[model samples]
Target: MTRTAPAPTRRPASTRGGPVRQGPGHRRAAWAAWGFLVPITAYLLAFYAYPMYRNLELSLRHYTVRSFVQGDAPFTGFANYLKVLTDATFVPALWHTVVFTVVSLAFQFTLGLGLALFFARHFPLSATLRALFLVPWLLPLIVSASTWAWMLNSDSGVINAALGAIGAGPVNWLTSPDWSLWSVTIANIWIGVPFNLVVLYSGLQAISPAVYEAAALDGATGWQRFRHVTLPLLRPVSAITLLLGLVYTLKVFDIIWIMTKGGPSGSSTTLSTWSYRLGFGNLVPAFGPGAAVGNILIAIALAFGLLYIRLQRRQDPS
Candidate 1:
């Protein structure tokens, strides 16, 4: 034991024969990271930031398209906002928007959730069927709206033809103010369902199979498993999709415009259509009011977006 050799002392890094060398790899990696970031930075600055600032500036100025073309406009403080807030047209339009958003969301979410759950179950041609269902979403908005408009036309349209064949009498699809919003909403629901389905299906796929197995082993049935596990797990994705759908549906202009142009008596006018009317409809263009409506929509959407970000943050604690 006494003769046992003492273990050789380990040399400190600084006491090594030569100083430790650092490769240029870290600096190169940093430069590579910035190089990759530059294009996105430039794109955001040029497209998103500048345009948003310009829109804000325009909202503050009393400028029409004519005035903009002539370059003879001045800032008008909060007069635009005041006019928008007080306008008789604006409030009803806002009400229509609210109703459309709520109604469409209700239908889309219910139908979408149902479709999502149905599609998540394994079946033949599931991928193909899912892709086919997305056709409405993939189609150009103008084209899809036009197609629906044609289908809903009072005379010789397919829907009216079908009604005639079925002895139900031809129903006014777009002409009536009462029916116009619902018709557009039907098209919107069709377009939006695929989006919700896709997102929810992906979220369902992300859930671990082990959990479902355990639930099944515990005698859980399909509905019970879905209620207890699927709904709760899909909450985050559902929240995001619902908020996005609300934001988009609130600003829907093309569907309404293409089908009815704010309708028989402006009954279907949403805030977006109202803004367009104010901007460029009649003898006197109300650019200020239009911009104000747009700004209001932006504010609402931003508020929702902030809420979404906060929820995502809470979910991701790390």
Candidate 2:
């Protein structure tokens, strides 16, 4: 029998030392990825990066209304920042910001955790009650602030009325310097609780039921199970929640502005309101100082964010 010549073997594309050709699908996927990236890139440039750049530039310049409009601002280096540091409002605003952030975060987290644990039992109407609790969060911030303003009115407010019914004297919620900071903090806590509840509740759900069962079988009480099992597992979620709440509280301006306009005499002024007051609340706005204050706020937030990331990396190493 005649032996047929062996059929020529085709080498694989990668083995042949030629450029490996990509399929149409690969090209399409690459194009789609680029398409997805382009809009977000443009948006960040337009909205975030550009604004930050402008704000930084503003902080470094002596820009009057004429110069601002004409784009002829004189470069002043750190003069604006120096002015802000030396300003009378700086210390008080910083202190108020700290108190507001810490107090609001404390109360909100505690109440939210309590509610989350309560609802995790999944009792009848728990979902309904949770939804109802979200009303403060669901209402527009302006509306909420306004309502608080009315309710806290010195003479004719509902809160004062309630206190009167209980035989307590009317306390100025929004008016008094001593109470103004607390008032805004309380309102902020009320608004923020639902967010915490939702997040913590979801975190609780992610804890396997078997973990709790195991703890129970080990003769752990309810408190012990929560202390050892629940709290440790919820650490990641709680950290993130607190961080977000801190950032949000640090920048809270609307509620304070609406209710107190940062004062009976600058008592409730946080950095955010102070920045706004410098930038726009006055007849002759201190644009440079305002921008400097904003930059300071940004730096604070960035520092905390970096710290959170560092702590997370230490915990997870991976």
Candidate 3:
């Protein structure tokens, strides 16, 4: 037929170029996504963002009990930060924090890696032993710290009694200035190892057994395989583990406070305990300086977290 076909209908330019009309299903999906997102956004704002803002405000103000309640605290700019930097406690607290974090991380990672490797063999009672090893980690921090305090007691402690049986002198673990940091550090190491073990063990389990078989067939010894294959594969997990441990160890206050109170002369006081002592451990609290110290700790953790993220990006092939 020579009759001209009817011209094809076309979408309006606005519909094509400006905005597409979403169907009911698309609208519902978008609403569902918002529904899922809104609660988390609200929660984060209420809990995390608001608290951080308040802390920052606190650090920048000269707040006393009167002013705090009245909400008339005067802003002092960076005076609080300067005061914290110049305070005599700053240097020692920073040093102690470094030592505590380093020693705990080193020992925990080493022991955890060793244990993970051992348990990877799937020996008899492996599951039982692994579960038992989680006791320190699973216990409440207060309970664990209290138990350590009692065990490390200078007088009538089981540790000292055991030392006595071995003809060794009893040492002041929690009381002495010389041993306070070390005592808390040992307790922290014990508490942290199980976490490291669980994480690293899971990482090891994700590794394919075929890789190990290939290494064995290529005449790679156990040490060689671990160094070349296992370690490389576990790099991502190890980085995250160490980063988390670093942040946690930096802010640890419960174990130190419960065990040693950062004392005999503040020898064991890290930044966290020092901050608490400033804020609430006295008759007249230095809220401004205390908040300043807390901000410093937060900054340190944030810096390390950023570094870890950057390193991860560089390591990621995609």
Candidate 4:
């Protein structure tokens, strides 16, 4: 019994080496990932991060065309920002920016949600109609602005023509100071609706039909179901949609520039347009002030983005 079995020998824990074998495959895979990321990292740094830093630097200094050319801009604390804040056009431009953003977002979201809901119904040609609606969003902003420019032109424009046909006086849409801002705002809304529709429609599709069935069983009517079930579920998607829409609308430049150039006594001048005016509009461009205004716009967009991030985390703690 004592000699029945010999004790098994225990193996050594390890040798002096940290890793017995370092795999070539794993090292190659890591290098491959770095290789793929390198170009994107370079592009972002070159195009976005570098430019933003340069612009911010320019904002804090007394920069000019000559200074820019010679690389010698004198540091001037917050004077440039002060100049922008005190400028007469600054207040009006800020107001126009606010009005344009608010009005365009309101109508865009409303019409887009309406279209999304309508298309959510599986009717004949629903998919086709939705695809066709994407034409506005796919077109270049220049082309869209040009088309609307012709449509909104004072004389011989389609819009005024329609008004004349309806016995209403032809309104100067782009030229009149009273209407220029609204005209651009309307054009922007038209351009933005298709994007919002696509996003919201996709969100709607992601929702389960079983939820609606449950709501119906609970005696919730159409509007009640939408408000209680659909809207609550759609909150996350809606937040992202509105957040992006706000940021894009705030930075709108091409439509305003192409259509009005913020014309007719600067009535339609938005913050973006005002920045352009300050920087390159004058013979002696005010680079510092222009950069300052641009930085302000960026700050606003950043604030909204941070808010969105905060909301997202709150909704999804994980």
Q: Which regions of candidate 4 fall more than 4 Å away from where they truly are?
A: 1-32, 313-318
Scored by CA lDDT, what does every candidate get?
A: 0.80, 0.87, 0.88, 0.87
lDDT of 1 by residue, 1-318 (tens): 001111111213244354233586867767787899999999999999998777777778889768877867798988889888887777778888988899999988888889888888789999899889888878888988999999988896899999899898887889988788888888888877877777778877878899999999999999999999899988887887787677677778888888888877888888888888887766787777777888898888778867766766565542
Clashing pairs in 3: none
TM-score per prediction, in order, is 0.83, 0.88, 0.88, 0.88
- In model 1, where is the ten-residue run with the lowest total lDDT? 1-10
Residue-level lDDT of model 2, residues 97-209, one tens digit each, is 99999999999999999999999988888899988988998888899999998998999999999999999999988889999999998889988999889888888987899
- Weakest ten-residue segment in model 2 by summed lDDT: 1-10
Q: List the residue pairs that clash in candidate 4.
A: none
Candidate 4 CA-lDDT value = 0.87
Please provide, for model 3 over 138-202, each residue's C-alpha lDDT reduced to its tens digit, 9 standing for 90 to 100.
88899999998999999988998999999999999988899999999999999999988988898
Model 1 bad stretches (over 4 Å): 1-39, 64-66, 164-169, 282-284, 316-318
Largest lDDT belongs to which candidate? 3
**Model 2 ranges with Cα > 4 A deviation:** 1-32, 309-318
Query: lDDT of model 1 at residue 208?
Result: 85
Count of residue pairs whose backbone atoms collide, per candidate: 0, 0, 0, 0
User: Could you give the C-alpha RMSD of every candidate to the true structure, in order shown?
Assistant: 13.1, 12.9, 12.9, 13.7
